[model samples]
Target: MTSTPPHQSVLDKPFVLDLFAGPGGLDVAGHRLGIPSLGIEWDKQACLTRYAAGLETLHADVSAVRRDSFESLPPEINVLAGGPPCQTYSVAGRGAGRQALEDVKGYIKRLMAGESDAEIDKKLMRLSDPRTALVLEPLRYAIQATRSPNRGHRPYDVIVLEQVPAVEALWERYAEVLQDTGLPDGTKYNVVVDVLKTETYGVPQTRSRAVLIARREGLGDAPSLPDPTHRAYEAKEWNRRNGGIAAAPVTQQTLYDVDAPEPRRRPTEDARLEHWTSMGDALAEPVGIKHRGRKAPFLVRSNYGSSGIPGRRGVRTDRQPATTVTGRISRFVVFEHLGHDVVCEGPRFSMNEAGMLQSFPPDYPWSGTAQAQQVGNAVPPLFGAHLLSAALGLPAPAAEAMREPWVPAAEEQRAKLRSHGCGAADGCTARCPRPV
Candidate 1:
């Protein structure tokens, strides 16, 4: 279990419960922003990861959770958050077919009704209660919930949803639900759907996530959306939407382009440049394998570019924001090392990097194999710190490096290396053999 810090007091102490909380990404963010959280996940490794992050977690299937049991806890649980498994709604998953939709619908019904049958109670936990406000994610579940017979009839005070562009239709449904369940006179609601990237908020990777926040009547003028504080762009079309005297558009350069006076175009041979351009590579330490076939299953293409795989040199750029980092790096972005123009034939984003880009603290522990650790995961606490800080009208606290054995030894080693005039290639340009 991760040890809690001494002499450090949590900020607001808003009690939160995370359902399907993978490695406590959301919980970490909440805590960094002053809210205390508990996580519920069935995967033992994921549960351990969350526990290591100093969160109290329940290692049980979400379907088996007893609402009556949670309701039994004090009413201090101000926020309830979770993303039901996305595979059901995933564009690639069972095609969101009738069976898939019905299965999820059944879950939503249990979520809102707080009712549990013998069969479902044996497998899942329900979240449909008034005391513990719900903040559902991925947009798909939220949209479906709004359309059910329980429309506008929910117990929570706020509903925040997020997803990819392909799921925007879900947001429209959320909007309609809000209209149908018109708020009481004094209650207010906000529906924000836009492209928000991790880099703009200080994460190193260039990941754009579409966020939708719906405020119930009581949560104080739905937390104001965090305004963009930084900027960069990919090409002319990248900023076609932002004209009139804007700063540089948020691009790969914003995070990686340090010390360079202007945006520099790197030729294909510069592996370092390619790594920086590839969000996945930037977060990953190369695995010493040449491009053979597809490396990971979750391969994503954002744009078009040239390739060098014999006759298969196809150019694809990842302009669109990535789907969730499912801990499967191969599922996020593509990579190419064929000495020709680099092609992202595999997923480029790693779950770890994506989590960091999502504001997870640098030290948050990830579970499962390396691939699972990289893609399918949580937005780091660091990312949540920015958003939560804004919501609570407080300054984000400085991150305290964890003093675990795994980390301190690395710090000591780096210090030793620094004394000998030897450091990683990225740092020691003059003294080291390779500069880059």
Candidate 2:
């Protein structure tokens, strides 16, 4: 394993080391914020996509890297962030992690008591699904970085971890341990944990994630989750009087409205948030027009039934935020309707459109198989920017700045591939011929 130092221009910037990085979502957010980042991903296809996006990457299993006590990790990295795979904890898959939650907490206690990795691995191998043990990998890295004398003695100033909502209990446990263990400088970490609603952060999709943010007490003020920038979405009756096209909800109150409004004025915090973005708002411009021929209104119908009941599929109109975009997003169907009649129907969302709903740029280069799965598994870059900003004690980026499109230059992509010992023909692996 090898690690590359940050470029001279960015050497002074806060560097982020992302583990279990799937196709560089948080890294993209870091790039936009002028922070430097490197991602460690084991999936070959995801690594290919990361290289195409010109993001720095180390393609290796996190456990293998952890074995070396992450010695190859760059000394300049000050921020640690990752979203562990959540299949076992997700409702869509077998609930192995959820069933073994109590046991996992025991493992955390053992780690705190200074148990060897080999001992833990021997027990973890007895689990029905070994992936359940991966959740502790980040905590292990944190403990070693802070307590190991061989390490440069420079602990990460900020630590961020995210997973499925089912893992919120685990995050609570993490917060307790992190705050309990003070650094050698006599400063401890201040931590906060919450399950954030994606729509509240301006994402045009309705999804929830368990997030944990920790900041070293010596590093300025304590950290908290960023304030909501958008109102939460609520299900309202669709108005059939206007062909089922519901009126857009009011986002804020103007001075005139506040003075003469029949409705009571909302509190200051409520008045500050904008309306939750709807699916139509995100896909209306080019995706709807290009794919469906008109931007009027559409309904997305799930192909699979819920909870093993056939013909019990769910549906969402364009007026509402999209239901969670998942790996099986391609199986959904979109229909254009006129009152009581169905005018036309087409394939649901294009990959680009799916990315947009997740708050990725419209032109983000997606080059991997199971692309939808990658997008679904990733943290929305918009949400990540806010989290990163709050964790690092930096001002949140402007809403417009978060929406801006970005693409790497041709030369930049070539240089990134070369740095990873990959070329167009080499396909981004160790056995590939070195660039001349």
Candidate 3:
């Protein structure tokens, strides 16, 4: 659910191309930044959600769509953003999934060696999981876009990709390929890859994602990643690494034991870094029907009646950030208060609250029946906004800008702050914001 940013560098790119676009999170962020965008999503359910929310989307399996078809679009369309499905690459599913990585890499190598799609698919079909190969779609688009047969189209100006941390090595591989490959006009890209924690950027959940940003080569200097604004855990690492000196020390962050009688964290060292919002803040107003079965009183997944430790099954008290809002968000039970014994129904997060945590409109017009899956799969539009802001060549935004709900720009408000004027023969304009 990562991608978005702040800035000294504002986006000059007029539009973004979101591939494997899930529920329009990236597009939502792009719209807020005055960048018009569209998404290509394969899932009918997510596309239904996209249409209900009034976000633009094209329904098609990203893998089934040919990259050459993109040549039909106007050359002005440039920034590319997407998060390919990561279930196969996620650490949570790593037992059989991890063991398949080597085989997956082998398949990718064959495809790289110019094997026919039919040939590779035949072999991949034999793997325990073929989804692992889907990770290469983004790279396929990047490589193809950078070397389009059409003479007039320019390569993508910026590329933003996100996935679970275990797939970072794949992004790093793509970065290497982008570095080594260039356009017919000698245009190349400067790429940066890193694993980021969404909570560090004001997300209520502590989800971690591997993010990649690639800017067309010779855009003055290389692209920089966005800086963090909120303080949850160790603002010091950010401050020291980025040469930032804050007025006060960062507040400590800790989660309370679900079964503990008292809170588990230390007192704040002043409130400067407490901007990290909690499950309490986002879910303050609940709208979903609470489950009220006394027999299954606030039970969490798998360990409904265990006395071992609450950590086995997280407590849904608002004291801490909610556990990663996975499909599992619906399995946990809620308590009325931090130390109260009262039990509340169903899941810890409603689909609306989950959307809010991911920086979507709380009441976004949702179209699908798999509410938790749709909510769990989105990038926080606020976070995507930050990543897009950085990709557009702006400096990281102050944390305060991210603390509240994101407000998008009007269509008429679109304006370019290019350092270099438009229609230049060389196509150079942006000034890179140094990475923090």
Top model number, TM-score: 2
- Please tell me which model should have the higher TM-score, number 2 or number 3: 2
Which residue pairs does candidate 2 place in steric collision?
none
State the displacement of the C-alpha of residue 376, model 3, in Å, after optimal TM-score superposition: 0.8
In order, candidate lDDTs are 0.41, 0.72, 0.60
**Model 2 residue 267 CA deviation in Å:** 7.5
Ranking under TM-score, best-scoring first? 2, 3, 1
Measured on C-alpha atoms, candidate 2 has an lDDT of 0.72
Q: How big is the RMSD of model 2?
A: 7.2
Model 1: per-residue lDDT, tens digit, 401-421? Answer: 211111212444434433332
Using all chains and alpha carbons, the TM-scores for the candidates as numbered come to 0.53, 0.83, 0.72
Off by over 4 Å in 3: 1-11, 72-74, 94-97, 103-126, 147-153, 181-187, 234-274, 285-311, 337-348, 395-436
TM value for model 3: 0.72
lDDT of 3 by residue, 250-310 (tens): 1111122233332223475334444566655555554323311112112223233335554
The 10-residue segment with the lowest total lDDT in model 3: 414-423
Comparing 1 with 2 on TM-score, the higher-scoring candidate is 2
